[model samples]
Target chain A: MATINDVAKRANVGRGTVSRVINNEPFVSEETRKKVLKAIEELNYHPSSFARGLASQNSYTIGVIMDNTMDKVYANPFIYEVFRGVEKSVYEGGYNLLLLGKNTYQNGKLAVERVLQGKMVDGLILQEQIIDSEYFKNIEQYNIPIVSIGKLENRDDISWIDIDNHMAGYMAAEYLYSRGYKKIAFEGVELEKIFARERYEGYKEFIGSKGLSVMEANELLQNIEGVICLDNIYAYKILQRCKKINKKVPEEIGIITFDNYPLAEYLQPSVTNIEIDLFQLGLCAGSEMLNKLRNRNCEVNRIRIPVSVNIRETTR
Target chain B: MATINDVAKRANVGRGTVSRVINNEPFVSEETRKKVLKAIEELNYHPSSFARGLASQNSYTIGVIMDNTMDKVYANPFIYEVFRGVEKSVYEGGYNLLLLGKNTYQNGKLAVERVLQGKMVDGLILQEQIIDSEYFKNIEQYNIPIVSIGKLENRDDISWIDIDNHMAGYMAAEYLYSRGYKKIAFEGVELEKIFARERYEGYKEFIGSKGLSVMEANELLQNIEGVICLDNIYAYKILQRCKKINKKVPEEIGIITFDNYPLAEYLQPSVTNIEIDLFQLGLCAGSEMLNKLRNRNCEVNRIRIPVSVNIRETTR
Candidate 1:
């Protein structure tokens, strides 16, 4: 039941000073901030999300737009990890989270708009592909800040936190070639998303630079070989079909995929793929969004999430 | 782009009737409901979460209390699936989501207070264990509606949607016994949560009912044999320690865990376990919570999430 006035009085500071410290405003001196924090701790003061949202208009709440309807894949795990990282930082910074939508539904934009126009959240973290030009066009009308998880090819206007997918692709191809596997094939979404194109570019560049001919057939398109994709069940189909192709994995042809999913290892041949640092990506995105909310920085933002290749039994 | 009035006029219903239908009021007749639905479909009208929350003082947003800090485990693909299910219904219901915190951080009443007092979310879907008594006691003060993924023991007053852990445990034990395994053990939390107790009870009942004398040493503490779990991590530590302890899994003793984690398969002799219908659980929870919210039903509550045993290479 202890109020802010009680903490302010006990901390020997004005209510405004206490509010400044609580808001994490930089104006309060370090000594005052410490005293205020100590007093808050002593009082066990829990700030309400609405009150915070009202006072600062910085709900610290980020609108995460995920295509939840997509099949649970390695890419999803990566995204989830990134979400964790972002959640960690957002919580530490004292922010609430607003999960927008699972990309399959068109309602995600409505969720975002609610937060934007209704003043529910401060900023948004969009992990979904901006395929709906109309959605984006409507979104562009509002000045609500957005930090897309992955970079978009044509939409350079939006801010995004992404991994160096191009470099990851190059590394995978180079690593496969170095391991004495020449006929390396890449698999995953062939969408215009930056990760896909960047990965393809990296894979092709690495192979071409080595004077190795990258076969056209090796480039698997959005359609996987015999994989049955039933609304986000891509991983199983890709693995099952790969088994039927009479292709000896790693021995005859090495395969690399973008986004490391959980079932990756459980697969028959076990997939060796690049793992994007989704946690760090989320953390960076959350932090950047927080920073933007604190200061209306409208400049174009692009954050690169780190990637690590999991050398598994699949690659031999 | 179409307004609610436009839809109402097209459907030949009052604007209030359209609103009631959109809000999912049960009083609307099926004929009128279909008309409103057709109008909505034809118009492609989207309801914002804020408008819905403000109009009814119900955000249609649920606070998902999950142990996100824990390592992503393979054994519990249900978590992801449940999340997907929750996403499906909640999104379709035009509700947003907010992941509250991991078990420890949101440990006691703080989590409940945040959700209840803050009024950020209309209802809570506790995805984690409800172990802390003080937390529950504090939560009772707010009078906010709650829908738990796990059971709240000894408190029949609250609403929750959970898996039949006892049945799941009974099934697992019976499966092991039927497979001709004489000695078997269950691994889970040593908390006040209903799941841990139910699973343990089931394990004991099945074994004792069979006239088999179960040894106490066979039961692993909160820490499973060979796993050094401090904060839901060190999952591989258990398998590594098993290697050190010379307790060959599925050979000398059989193991069954409650929640399936990710790295369960990577270990030699992948774990045999039951999978909670997390998606169904989530969907049901959302559906039930929304129903309760609308009807304010007090007497009829409590939903048991169905579970299935996933027999992998682990069980002998």
Candidate 2:
């Protein structure tokens, strides 16, 4: 419960200057105003007794911080399902979500600070793998609860609810194998994060430990009988390349992909996809966030929602 | 500013119950708690003086309300582009966005009231057409500003920014004509709102006034020389139908669509689309909300962002 006096002292400015910035009045220089704001953020100062109390109290708002840029996030169908699931759970738990993108690198190192500065939300939901080291830096100080959508090695302390990416990858390979394709290869983006890496690791483990054949893209088209695409976009692109080269599917090669959205079902020959319940993952994440809100220190929970294969024309 | 007594009297409960509810204590009856919460919401009551002042003051938060359900809204790529634009403008303006879906009918009437109850946001940026009549129910009393993404005949009073849908329709027909297609037809979903209708109306106007030929999906496939798909999904479906029937694009039948994202560029012969700057529309919508926040009683402004034709293999 920091007051205006504390803000003024920390900012090295007069009490009147602090009051001016708090009241949003004129006569305060930009430098002085910024200093006051920084101090206020640092001290978690609220102008009135209630504002200060509200800082420690419940706002009943849950925030979502997407680690990826807007283009990457919005273009994919994964968010739509996951967010809807979250929305369903949050609303059911009497909470509303604040959407934030991590693209605000210059504004603040971590977007989570925005809510902490205002005491705007009781908890937060982090989507995707935690890449930036700055994300959970002072998370303990603010005492805000967080739940991740995907599991990573570095994000061990946080309560995470995720669909088993490793299992999903294994299932992609197994599905193609059952379709009678013997020499299987895996296709993935050149540079990817932990979740994508987990998928590749899972696929690699299942593809036979001894004498692994060449599995890269060009090699995949030439040497492999079937290919498991790690990404939906990569799957679509491979299909395009195959078509351009006049390679016949299920005859020359068998193609299988995971979590294809907005297009895979409609893509010509209608892609054979491993449909993941991302919506279920989102719903569970929201429920987990509520659990964190209602009962604090109730042991960090780890959950894995199930996945299944949606067989289509790409595979025999 | 509402006092605790106002809430107590209004809720027909003792001051202690009201205080308990305000402090989020246990032992209050669910019925009585609902009454107190409703009373608090209706009266805009805050327990502390600073909380009361903060309610009337700027929360420095902007909200985005999508009037559609999760499945319908998330399946489309429009939200990704639009919201990113809103995020850009709002962050630059030093504000954060609260994302709300209108699917909470049983929980509450309108999703916008969730923010208004706590004075959580200074303004809101609405995505898509306003279908629900209850949206702006008590907007005047709240004094929070709003900017809409699309135009509906009913939502004329609110400040709105939109792409030229009618012009987009006309452009689709014009593009087909330039590509040597004599007859053009329009395909849309069975049920659509103002935005979709506006596109059809614009295309119809451009297709010729006297004795318009039958332009339904079946008729377009058989009789019509070319077809302008209203929705991106419809465009993909039409292309799939063409592939099934062995209809060669730009030769047997020309095809054109609007605002195709994530898939249109990848859909085989690809797709010629009318590209709308939905992100820019969102940016302007956010900027408009800021302007409204800065200068109250400002005249409402309706802006139309420009559009362009992305020529692809679909239409020669």
Q: DockQ: which candidate is best? A: 1
Error of 2 at B3 (Å): 24
Worst 10 residues of 2 chain B by lDDT: B46-55
TM-score computed on alpha carbons, candidate 2: 0.73
By DockQ thresholds, what CAPRI class is model 1? Answer: incorrect
lDDT of 1 by residue, B1-316 (tens): 5677999999999999999998688889999999999999898775544444435556556777655646663334346556666766775665667876553233234543655655667776765355345555665566667776777656676777778877776777788787776555544445565576777677778888988644333223222221112111232334444556776665555555555544344434556667666668878987777776667766657777767767765456
What are the models' TM-scores? 0.65, 0.73
Q: What is the lDDT of residue B170 in candidate 2?
A: 82
Collision pairs in model 2 = none
DockQ, Cα level, model 1: 0.17
